[model samples]
Target: MISKSTIDKVFESARLEEVIGDFVQLKKSGSNFKGLSPFTDERTPSFMVSPVKQIWKDFSSGKGGNVVAFLMEHEHFTYPEAIRYLAKKYNIEIEETEQNEEQKQQANDRESMYLVSDFAQKYFEDILWNSEKGKAIGLSYFKERGFTDDTIRKFGLGYSLDEWEAFTKEALDKGYSLDFLGRTGLSIIKENKQFDRFKGRVMFPIQSMSGRVLGFGGRILVNDKKAAKYLNSPESDIYHKSKVLYGIYHAKQSIAKEDNCYLVEGYTDVIQFHQRGIENVVASSGTALTPEQIRLINRLTKNITVLFDGDAAGLRASLRGIDLILEQGMNVKVCTFPEGEDPDSFAKKNAYEDLVLYLQENAKDFIQFKASLLVEEAQNDPIKKAETIRDIVQSISKIPDRIQREVYVQECSRIMDISEEVLFNTLAQLGKKNVAEANKKFKKERKAFEVVKKEQAVEKIDVQYQLERKIIEILLLYGNRTEEFEDLLLKENEEGELVLEPELHKARVFEKLYLDLQQDEIELSNENFRTVYYGLISKLNEDDSFVIESYINGLDSELSKEVTSILMEEEKYDLSDWEGKDIYVKDKAESVAQLVGETILNLRCFLIDKRVSDLRQRTLEKKDGNNHEILEEIMNYHQLKKLLSTKLNRVL
Candidate 1:
C-alpha cells in the first residue's frame, strides 16, 4: 500500500498543465490551453488544460481529471503506477511500503516487459559501442554513414550477435520469460527451436512518442542475396508498423517547437538528419505513408514538409504520400534534394542553419511542385496535359475541409491553365463520389437510434432509486442537527410537570437520516460515488450546503461516467409529467411521505401489540410489575395507540 502522505506529496508536487503539456501541444486559449485531443482524431483543438484548476478536460472523450488521474487514464497506469510515473516525471523520489514475499515476486507485467526491453536496448547499445565485433560491424556502418558516436547513443543504436541463440539464452538465464521475448518478436520460436530474430543486424529501437521502446527495426549487414535487406519486429500488441514512426520519440519536441514536421523515407535518413541537427524530422521507415502515422505528426504540427531525394524514382514515389497528407487536413509542402543527393548527403554538405534556410526558401506547395515536375512530360501534348491538370484537381478534391479544398482548387486552376468553374465542378463531383461511398459504408452497417419513447427503463429506475438514496444518505449524515418536522413534543410546566404540546418543529429529513444511519451499518460499493457521497455527508454533518455540480465536475471520468449517467439519464420519475398525463401514482414521488405514515402507524400498532406480549410474559414470570401495574401500562399504551392510529390514518 502507498502511504496517504506520499500520495498527497506526489499530488501536491505534480502540476497538471506541466504534466499534460508533455503529451499534448497546448496553446493558450483565454484561461486554458486548448489543443487537439490526443484521445480522439480531431481537426480543431478541443482538449483543454486548465492550469488554474490543475486538471485537463478532453472535450472529445469527455474525460477530465487531475494530473495523476490523467496519467492513470491516458497511460493506463494503475493508481500506484500512475503515482510513480508522475513522481518520475517531476523528479520526486518514491516512498512505498515494504512488500511481502508474494508481492515482491509479483511484479507488474507491463512494467516487467518495459524493464526487459529497456535493459535489452541498453545491452544492445553497449555492444554496438564497446565490442570489437560491434565496432567492426555496427559502429563502422553508422560512422561510415556520418553518424557520430553521440548520435548513435542518442538513438540507442545496437547490433545483434550473429550467434542465433545468444540473446534468448542470456535473457532466459536472467529469468526473463521466453514467452515475452516471443511476444515482442525479439526471438522467433518454431517447434521448440528459438533464436534471436535480428541476428547480425544493426538495431533501431522503435519507440512510442513518449520514448518507451515498443519494439525494434533491424538492418542486415551481410550481403546475403536471398535474404531480406531489412526486417522489422512483427506486429505485436506494442508495435504496429503502419502506425509507428521511427524517431518520433526524439523529434516530437522539435516538431512542436518548430510547428512543422519533416517527413523522411528511411531510418538512416532520420538518424543522419538528426546527426546534422535537423531535430524535427521523422522516418516513415519504408512503409507507405499512413493516416495514422501522419496524424501522430499532426498532433504536434499541422504542416508537414516531405523531403525526397533528387532521384527520379524518389520524386515519383513522393507523389503517392501527398494525397494522404491532404486527406488528413494537413498543410503539406514538398522539397527535394539535388540529383544523386538525399537529405543525409545534403545535410553533411551544409550546416543546420543553411539546410533549414534551403528548406524554407525552396519548399513548394504540392500543387506547384507536381505541376512543375510533370510539366515537361505533358509539354506540347494536349492529351497528357489535360490529364495532368485533372490529376492535380483530383488531389485537391481529397482534402476534407471545404475551404482548404476551395483554395487548392483555385491554385490548381491557375497553374494548370484550366477554368475555375470547370475544375470546381470536377472537384465537386469527385468529392461527392467519395462521400457517397463513405455514406454507403456507414448506412449499410444498420446502426441508428431514434427517440421513439424508447429507453433502457431499468437503468432509469436504478437512477431514480439512486436519487432517493442520495436524499436518504444526506439525512443520515446530518441527522444530529435540528431539523424541521411536524412532530408533537412535551413541554415542562412551572412545577416541573410535563404538559403535552400539539406540534413541534424538529427532526428535519436530513437529521432523521443522519441519526438513523448512525444507528445502522452500511457501506457504498462504488468507490468514487462513495467518496463524493461521503464528502457530502461530512459537509451535511457540518450543516453546510451540499454542492453537487462541483462534486460531479471534480470527479474522475469512471465516476463521472456513472454520476452523469445517473443525473442526465434519470427522467419519467419526476412525477410532474405523470400528473400532466392525469396518471396519479399511488405513492406519487412521495417516498418519505408514504414511508413516514406507514411507519408511524405500524409502530403504534406494534407497540400496542408488544406491550400486551411483554405484560403477558412478565406477569406469567411474576416479575417487576403486578397485574395492576400491567393494567395501567396497557391502558396508557391503548391511549397512545389511539393517537398514533388517528395521526397515521389522517396522513394516509
Candidate 2:
C-alpha cells in the first residue's frame, strides 16, 4: 500500500492536463483544455480538463474524475500502479509497503501475466548486461547495428539464452507461475514438457501507451532454415499485436508535442529513428495496419507520415495500408529512402539533420506518391492507366472530410493530367457503390435492431431525482460559500390567501441547504446521490475550507465518478464559446443563495406533489368509498404545494 503522504504529494505535484496531454493532444479552450475523446471515437473535441479543479471529464463517454481516475480508466492501471506512475513522472518518492506473498498470489490473471512479462523484461535486460553469452551474442548484435548502450537500454533490448529450458526453469524457480508463462507464450508447454519459446534470440519488449510491458518480440540470431527469424508473444489477455504499436510508450508525448507521427514497418525502424533524434516514430511490428493501431496514433495527432523502404515491390504492397489511414480522416504523407536503403539503414548512415532534411524533402502526399508510382506502370497502356486513375479516385473516396477529399481530387487531376470533373464523377460512382454495400450489410442487422427498439420502453423524467441531483451539485460547487439569502415565510394575506413573504438572512450555502433539507425530512431518492450528499455534508461540516481534490480522492470509485460528473456537467457548455455568440451565460456563483434556495424549494414542492399523488391513489384504491380522511390529507398537501410554488415564483 502506498502511504497517504506520498499519494497526497503525487496529487499535488501532478498536473491533470500535462498527464492526459501525453496520451491525447490537448488544445487550449478558454480556461480549460479540450481534445478529442480518448475513450471514444470522435471527430470533434469533447474531452475536457480543468486545471483549476485538477480533474478531467470526457463528455463523449461520460467518464470523469481526477488524474488517478483517468489513469485507471485509460491505462487500466491498478490504484497503486497509477500512483507509482505519477510518482515516477513527477519525481516524487513513494513510500509503499511491500506486498506479501498471499497478496501477490491473489493478483488477477491479466495482472499476473503483466507481472510475468515485466519480470521477463528485467531478467532479459540483466542477462544482456551481465551474462557472458548475452553480451557476446545479443549485445554484439545490437552494437553492430549501431545501437548505443543508452538506446539499447532505453528500449529494454535483451537476450534469451540458447538453451531450451533456460527462461522456463528460471521463471518457475523464482515463484512466477508457469500457467502465466505458458499463457504469455514466454515458455512453450506441450503435454508434460516445457521450454523457452525465444531460445537463442534477442528480446525487444512491447509496451502499452502507459509503458507497461504487455509482451515481447524476439528475433532469432542463429540461422536455422526451418525456424522463423522473428517471433512475437502469442495473443494474451494483456497483449494484442494489432492494437499495440512498437515504441508508442516512448513516442506518445513526442507525437503529441510535434503534432505528427512517423509510422514505419519494423521494430528496428522505430528504434533507429528514435536514436537519430526523431522521437515521434512507431512501427506496425510487421503486422498488417489495423484500425485500432491507427486510432492509437489518432488520439495524439491527425497527421501521419509513413516511412517506407526503397524497395519498389514492398512499397507497392505497403500502399494498400495508406488507404486505411485515409479512411480514418488522417492526413497521411509517405517518404521513401534511397534505392538500396530502408529507414533503419538510412537513419544509421545519415546525420540527424540530414535524415530530417531528407524526410522533409522527400515526403509526398499519398495521392502524389500513388500517382507517381503507378503512372510508371501505366505508361503506354491505356487500360492500365484508366484503371490506375479509378484506383486513385477510390482511395480519394475513402477520405471522410468532403473538403479534404475535393483537395485530393484536384491534386490527382493535376498529377494524372485528367480533368477534375472526370475524377469527381468517378468519386461519386465509388461513393454510391460503397453506400450500396453498406446498406446491404446494414439491412441484415436492421431487423434485429428494429425488434430491440420496439421492445425498449420510453424513459420518463424523474422530477425528484433531478431536484435531488441539483441539491448535490449546489453543495459541491458552492457549499463553502457564505451568501445572503431571501428566506420565504408563509403569511396570511388580507383576503385569507396564504402568501410568501421574504426575510433576509446570511448563512453558508451548505448550512442553509442542510437545514432546509433536514427541516423538511427530505432524503435523496437516488442511492448514489444520497450517499455522496451525506458524505459531502459531513466533510463540509468538519472543515470550513474544503479541498475538493482531496475529498474526491478519499471517496470510493463509484462516488468519485458521481461527484466529478456533476461538477463537470456545466463545463461542457463553456467549451461552446457561448459568450462569443452574444449569448451571455449567468455565472452560478453570483446567485449562490438563490440557486440553493430554489433547489430546496423545488425539492419541497416535488415531495409535496408526490405525497398528493400517493393520497389520490389511496382514495382511488378504497373499495368502501370512504376517502374523507385521505381527501383531507390530499387537500393539505395541495395547500403546501401552492405555498411552495408561490415561493418559487411559479403559478400553481
Candidate 3:
C-alpha cells in the first residue's frame, strides 16, 4: 500500500485540468475549462473542469471527480494505480510500507500481472541496450529500418536474446512467479521447461491509455521462413488486444489537441508518423478493425481519417472500417497513399510538410470515397449499381446524428446520380426493419423491466431522505459558520400547565445541528449520510475554520464522491445564463440560518408524521378494544407534526 503522505502529495501536486487535459481538449471558459466529454460523443461541450476546486464534472455523463477519481473512472485504474500514475507524472517519489507475508498474499492477481509485464519491458530494453547479441541484431534491425535512436527509446523498443531460458532465469531470480510470467505471456513452459516467448525479437511494448505497459508486440528479425514475422502477447488478466489500440498512449494528447486522429495499420506505421511530427495517429496493430477500437478513438475526437495504401487490399480494409466508424457515429475520412506504398513506407519517403499536404489534399469523406470506389466497379451494370447504392445507404443509416446522415445522403444522391427520395425510401425501410427487430427484443424483456421499475419505485427517495440530505449538505457547506437560531420547547410553568417557551441561541452551525438532532432523538436514515454527518461533526469540533478539501481527503472514495456530488451538482445549472440575464443569485451563506432551520423542522415533522401513522396502524390492527393509548400517542404526534408544519409555512 502507498503511504498516506505520498498520496496526499500526489493530490496536492496534480491539477485537475492539467491531468484531464491529457485526455480531453479543454477550452478556456471563464474561470473553468469546458470541453466535449471524453466519455461521450457530442458537439456542444458539457464537460467542465474547475481549476480552483481541482475537480471536474461531465454534465453529459454525470461523472464528476478530482484527479484520481477521474483516472479511476476514465482509465479503469485502481486507487493505487492512479496514485502511482500521478506520482510518476509529477515526479513524486512513492514510499510504500513493506508488506508481510499475509499482506503480500492479499495483492490482487491483476496487479501482479501488471508488475510482471512492466518488468519484462524493462528487461527487454536493458538487453537491447546492454547485451552483446541484442545490440548487434536488434539495434541493427531498428537502425536499418530508418528508426532514429531517440525514436527507438521513445517507443521503448528492445530486444530479447535467442537463448531459450535467458529471460526466464533472470525473471525467476528476480523473485517473480512463473504463474504471473505465464499469465502475462512472457515466459512459456513446455514439459516443465521454461522458455522466453519473444526470444531473438525486437520488442515494442503496448501500453494502456495511461501509459502502463499491458503487453508487448515483437518483430522477429531473423529471416527464417518457418517463423512468424510478428508476434503479440496473448490475452491475459490485464491485456485485451481487441480493447487496446497501439500508440493510443502516445497519441491521446495530440488527438485531443489536433481534433483529429490518423488511423494506420501497423506499429511501425504509427511510429513513422510520430517520427514525422504527426503525433495524432494510432494503429489497429495489424488486426481487423473492431468497433471497440473505433469507440476508443470516439472518446477523444469525433473526426477520424484512415490512411491506406492506394491498392485494392487497402481499399478493402478501408471499406471494412468505414461502416464500423459510421456505426460508432464518428466522421471518418480516407487518405490513400500512392500505389504500392503503405503508411510506413510513404511517411518514410516524404518530408513532413509534403506528407501533411498530401493527406489534407487527398482526404475524402466516407460517402465520397465509397461512391468513387464502387462507381467504376458498377459501370454499365444496373443491378450491381443498385446494390452498391444500397450498401452506401446502409452505412449512412448507421449514423446516429440525423443532420450528418441527411447531408451524407444528399451527397450520395449527387454523386451516384440517384434521387434523394429513393435513398430516403431505402433508409426508411431499413429503419423500420431495425425498429421491428428491436421491438421483438423489447417485448421479450418488458416484464422483467417492469418488475425492476416497481422495485426501484419502492426504493425511491422518501421525505426523510430529502430532509436528511439537505441537513447534511448544509452541515458540509456551512458547518463552522455562526448562526442565530430560535430554540422552542414545551415546559411545565408555575401553574402546572404545559407551555411553549422560545429562546434565542447564537451558535455555530455544527453546534446547532448536533443539539437539534440530539434533542429530537433523530438519526440519519441513510448509512452513508450518517457516516458523513459524524465526520462533519468531528471535523468542525477540531478545526476553527472549515476546509472541505482537507475534510474530503480523509474520506473513503465512495463517501468522498457522494460529498462532492452534493456540493457540485447545483453548480452545474449555476454555470448557465441565469446570472448574465439580470437574475441575482443569493449566496448560501446569506441564507444559512433559514436553510438550516427549515431542514431541521422538516425532518422533525416527517418523523412525527411517521410516528402518527404507526400509531394509527396499531389502532387498526388491535382486535382487543385497547385503542386509548394508541389514540393518545397518535394525537400527540399529530399535534407536533402540525406545529412543525406551521413553522415551515406548510398546511398539513
Candidate 4:
C-alpha cells in the first residue's frame, strides 16, 4: 500500500491546471480554468479546474476529483499507476514496496486490460505500416479514402492478413496473452477453432472515451456480398457497442475546446470531418444513440450538433436522438447536408473553413429543425398535425431545465404554427407526468440506497457511532476550550521586579477532552475521525496550525460534510461572544494570557481528578508505602479538586 506521507506529498505538489492542461487546452475562466472534457466528444468546454482547491470537475459528465482521480479517469490508470505516473512526471522518487513475481503477474484488472488494449492498438498500427500485405490492402484503402498517412496513423487504422491465424500467431509469439487478445476481440476462438477475428479485414479499433482500445470494428475489403460488411467485437468486460462512440477518445479534448460535439452517424463520417480539421466530432458508428453514448459525450460537452446525411435522411435518422438529447439536459442542434450528400463527401468537397461555416449556417435548434421538416408531412390533416405537435412538445418537455424547455416550447409554437397556450398546456401535462415517473423511480432508488446504507452500518457498528459523536463534537465545540492550569507563582527578584511563572500550566479542552477519553480507555470510534484526529494531533505536535479545509479536501463527501458540519456547528457555539459571563475577562495581554493558561490548567486538573476518583470508586488502591503517605496523597488530591472547582466556578 502507498503510505499516507507519499499520498499527501503528491497531492500537495500536484498543480491542478498543469496536470489537467496536458489533455485539455484551458484558458482563464474566472479564478479557475475551463476546457473541453477529455472524457467526452464535444465542441464547447464545460470541464473546470480549481487550482485553489486542487480539484477538477466536468459538469457535463458529473465526474469530479483531484489530479489523481483525473489521471485514473482520463488515462485509465489504477491508483498506484496514477501515483507512479505523477511521481515520474514531477520527478519525485517513489518509495514502493517490492512486489513478488507472482503478485506482479496476478490477473489484470480493468486498467490492465486498457494497457493491454493500447499495446495491441500500437502493435496493429505497426502491422499496418511495416508489413507488405498491409501496405497493399489497408494502406491503399485508407489512401483511397483520401486519408493522409498522418491521419491514418493518428486514428491507428490497421489490417489483418487474409491468411487465417497470421495476426493471431504473431500476437501470441510476442508474449501477449491469448486470453487478453480474445477479450479485446483481436483474436477469435471457436470449438477448437482459433484465429484472428478480423482476418482479411481493415481494422478500426474502437476506443473507450479515454482512448483505450476496448474493442474493434473491422471492414472486409474482399468483394463478397456473402460476408457481412462489418464485424464488431461482441460485448466483453470492457466494450459495449450500444454505449460507445467511435473517435470519442481522439475527439474528446477537441470537443471540450469547441464547446460542442459534432455527432455523425458513421465511422467514415467522423474520419472525414476529422481529417478535414473538424476535430471536435465523433460518430455513433451507425448504432442508435444509447443513453450511455450520449452521457459519454455529455462528459465532454453539453452542446451537441448532429451532422445529418441530408435533410430528408437526417430528419428520419435524428428523431430518437432529438428527444433523448433534450432529455439529457443537452443543447441539441441539427444540421442536414444537401440532398444525396453526407458529412464524409461534403467534407471532402469543402475546405475546413467552408465545412465550419456550412455547419454554422445550416444548424437549427432541434425543435425548429423538426417542425420545419415535418410540418409539410402533416399538411392540414388535423389528426396527423396534432400528433406532430405532440411529438415536438414531448421533446420540449424532456428538457431537464425549465428555461430551456420554455425556449424550445416557444420555438415549437412559432415553427408549428400552433397556439402558444395550447403548446404550454400540453407541455405542462407531459412535464408533470415525466416528473412524477422520475420521482417514483427516485424514491425506489433512494429506498434501495437506504437499505445498502443500513447494511453498511450494521457491518461497522462502533465505528459509525464514534464517527457520529466525534463529528458532532467537532462541529459543536472546536474553538471553545475549557482551560485546566491553576496557579501563577510570583517571585520578587533582586531588582524588586516580580517574576511570575505558572506553578501549574493549563491544557486546552480539546487536549483535555482527548486525554480524558484516552484515560477512560476510550478512542475516537469514527474511522475517518480516528484517521483525522491522529493526523491533526500529529500535525499540531509538529507545530502546525490545524487546517480543517485542507484535511477536508482529502476526505470523501460523507466525511467532508461531517467535517463541514463540525466547523459550521462550532460557529453556533460562539466562542468570542461567550465572554460576557464575568468569567476569565482580562484588560491586558498578560492578563489575557494568564487567564487562558489558568483555565486550561484548571480543566486538565479536574479531568485528572475525576479519572482518579473513578479509578478509586471502581477498584480500591491496595498497597501503600505508609498509611500517612496515602492519607497525605488523599489530602493533596482534595486540594487539587477544590482548586479545580474554584477555577471552574470563576471561568464558567
Best by TM-score: 2
Model 1 Cα lDDT, one tens digit per residue, 1-652: 6766677777778877777766677787645677888878888776776665455666567766667667767666666777777777778777778789898567776666666677678878878888889899989998888888789889999998888987888888988888888888888988979999989999999888767788888899888998789998888766789988999989988888898999988888898889888899999988889988988888788999999888847566669799999988899999988999888788888988998899999899999998988887799899989888878887888788889888888888788778899998888788789899988987766454333335435534443335344543333333234544455444676997545455645555555544433443434445655665566567566645644444544456676544443432222143124565777556423355345334434534654666688977777888554578877887776666665666566431
Better TM-score candidate (2, 4)? 2
After superposing candidate 4 on the true structure, give the runs of residues whose Cα lies further than 4 Å from its correct spot.
1-14, 18-50, 53-66, 73-76, 83-100, 107-112, 311-317, 432-523, 527-652
Q: CA lDDT of 23 in candidate 1?
A: 66
Clashing pairs in 1: 475-510, 475-513, 475-514, 476-513, 476-514, 479-511, 479-514, 483-508
Backbone-clash count (model 2)? 0
Worst 10 residues of 2 by lDDT: 311-320
lDDT of 2 by residue, 377-469 (tens): 899899999999998998999899999999999999899999999889889999899999999999999999899999999999988888888
Candidates ranked by TM-score: 2, 3, 1, 4
Report the C-alpha displacement of residue 516, candidate 1, in angstroms: 15
Candidate 3 lDDT over residue span 1-652, tens digit each: 7999999999889888888888776777657777777787665678888787677788888787778889988887888899999999999999999878997887788888988998999999999989888889889888887999899999999998988889999999999999999989999987769899998899999998889899999998779999889999999978889989999999999998888999988999999999999999999898888987887887678899988876646475458778888887789998888888888888899999999999999999988888888888999899989999998998999998999989998999999999999999999999999999999999999999999888774456678877888888888778898988888787778997555577888999999999989987888989999999998898899988777776776778888777777777666664574667888777777888888888888777778878888888888899997999889878777766766777778987
> Looking at model 1, which ten-residue stretch has the lowest summed lDDT?
567-576
Error of 1 at 279 (Å): 1.3
Between 2 and 3, whose lDDT is larger?
2
Q: On a 0 to 1 TM-score scale, where does candidate 4 land against the true structure?
A: 0.69
**In terms of lDDT, which candidate is strongest?**
2
Ranking by lDDT: 2, 3, 1, 4
- Scanning candidate 3 in windows of ten residues, the lowest lDDT window is 569-578
lDDT of each: 0.74, 0.91, 0.86, 0.71
Give the lDDT of residue 79 in candidate 1.
Answer: 69
Error of 3 at 436 (Å): 2.7
Model 4 accuracy (lDDT, Cα) = 0.71
